[model samples]
Target: MSTDPTRLSRLPIVQAPMAGAGGPALAAAVTGAGGLGFLAAGYRSADALAADIAELRALIGAAPFGVNVFMPHHTATPAEQERLRRYARSLARAATRYGGTVGTPAPGAERDDWDAKLALLLAHPVPVVGFTFGLPDAAAIAALKAAGTLTVATVTSPAEARLAADLGVDALCVQGAEAGGHQGTFDNPDDPAPYGLLTLLALIAPETDLPLIAAGGIMTGRQIEAVRIAGASAAQLGTAFLRCPESVASAAHKAALADPAFEHSVLTRAFSGRWARGLRNGFVARHEAEVPGVYPYVHHLVSPIRKAAAERGEPDGLALWAGQGWRLARAEPAADVITRLVDEMAAARKAHA
Candidate 1:
């Protein structure tokens, strides 16, 4: 079976899997609208992920969808760990303000439950499975293949794309620098290359035969058509779907997307300790410089603070993840968003022709 991303959906649109923002209902809505919806398995236990898969299946029936899991690769040395500890100490004042304590992460506590999630997928396979943050091993890829699952690896550069291709992934989601939320930079999480989606696609298309799904700041039909012209099989969008009614984005988050006071998005590791693009907020402005380039460690350290901020309805403290095209995001149904995108894409293609 071919793992062509274009063939998975009637429209060449994919709703990018956002950890907390995306849910089964959002995925079902996109799938029902002839685009591929995705269930994000990030930040969820295996049991929770399994339950979501079942719910999505019930909602969308046999409509093809995908599941995205964060590929686990924690390379935090003792030095990095100490740096994370120092970073935690620096946030003590802020933690006090939030009425929370930054707990010291135990050694190897940053694991994202990769093993259990993989086991769950093997037992009950989905149509498409995507791995982000890092690439899985060949055996893992083969296991998903044996279960009739189309495997996708998210890549940020031509080098990453080639590495994923060598691992025999069915497809590649070529994410760019402008992408919101956490970047999928597997090797060097600290410094990511600043390449736009079209530029990265052009750089990667010549290196691999795998079907390429372009993801980044893509939002409108014109942007989708632009990527298609640059050799992308499809475009994956996250922020555009964020305002959809089915999205699990907090009410504060939804409002922030529309709030002009928020201004622009910036790539900051203050929230997760990895380079992720999001709306610049007070937390980012205050701590981006102090953030250590450690992942799940910093993620765990700040978890309580973020949770407290969310509870207090303070957008400034929460990670307002959004791409550059967030200004164009509209509050509508996911299906309507897809329909409008398809129509806009058609118009753009026709205009270009």
Candidate 2:
């Protein structure tokens, strides 16, 4: 492994910056194991993000790391809001139990403190900063570059990949349709352009020379190598690491992940307005087709209900995101997970030889 930014095997693995589920401890653990880790500043206050950055520095010391930022999103039109409200009412039963009604909340200036976060980065720049959900345009990218930050943006299709590459980002986190959490759709969330990891890697390869980190349904060393063989520079894994000790996943999420009934995964817009693949459950089954058109607006509305459900130990009402490869995820220390992955990669290589 060399000090090259344009290569993959240089580190062997890189931790996916999973919003809500990722934290400093998981990032530090990955970095400590000779893999690049990332801090996800998607849904946090600027002060909170700064504190997280400070804590990560203290924890990882000299290990290289990165931070992920959610692209600023605007409110949907009034028609869309009404449409989402109509959809939210379907979850009324679950909300009633928590003394709340779904879809009644309105989204008001729910920016994730972009300016303050940018200022903080300017004052204390990390090695890397990644953008998701959408591209940050040319100006934001330049500002981040001026602050000595290597920029990365997540894209699903080659069309999006080319657009991001042309935006002058340092790298592209090409997320596949099977990826967990938010879909990161730059355009409308309803118009989901599903593409598998290998196909996406291949599609983007012919269009741009930017470094690509493949994500989605990545579970084993062989799967990682398959992405590399398909033209990805590196593999970014999240679902495989969900069970890691360093991860901040809740008990309900962990329990559902292990449950055989939740083994099947589907792309649902019930949790968030954007589509994300997760362990199919009662909530998803009930509201998949009735979902609204807003992005985080609907998500913001139901978050309280979700929070209340978690507090009440109601797994059926919570959002449990997982990839198709949930069956292979193991509950172990993060160090062990990373070590075992590297070992498996080495073994696979030797076996092929």
- Candidate 2 residue lDDT tens string, 246-320: 888777787778877665788888877778788887777777778785676767767877777777766777788
Runs off by more than 4 Å, candidate 1: 103-108
Those runs of model 2 whose alpha carbons end farther than 4 Å from true positions after fitting are 1-10, 98-110
lDDT of 2: 0.79
TM-score for candidate 1: 0.96
Candidate 1 residue lDDT tens string, 1-353: 45675697888999999998999999999999999999999878899999999999999887889999987756689898788878988889778877667766665555688899999999999999999888888899999999999988999888788888888988999998889998888864555667888889999988777888999999999999888888889999999999999999888898999999999899999987888899999999899988988777787888788777777778887899999999999999999998899899889978978
* Consecutive 10-residue window with the lowest summed lDDT within model 2: 1-10
Report clash pairs, candidate 2. none
**What range of 10 consecutive residues in model 1 has the weakest lDDT sum?**
102-111
Q: Which prediction has the highest lDDT against the true structure?
A: 1
Clashing pairs in 1: none
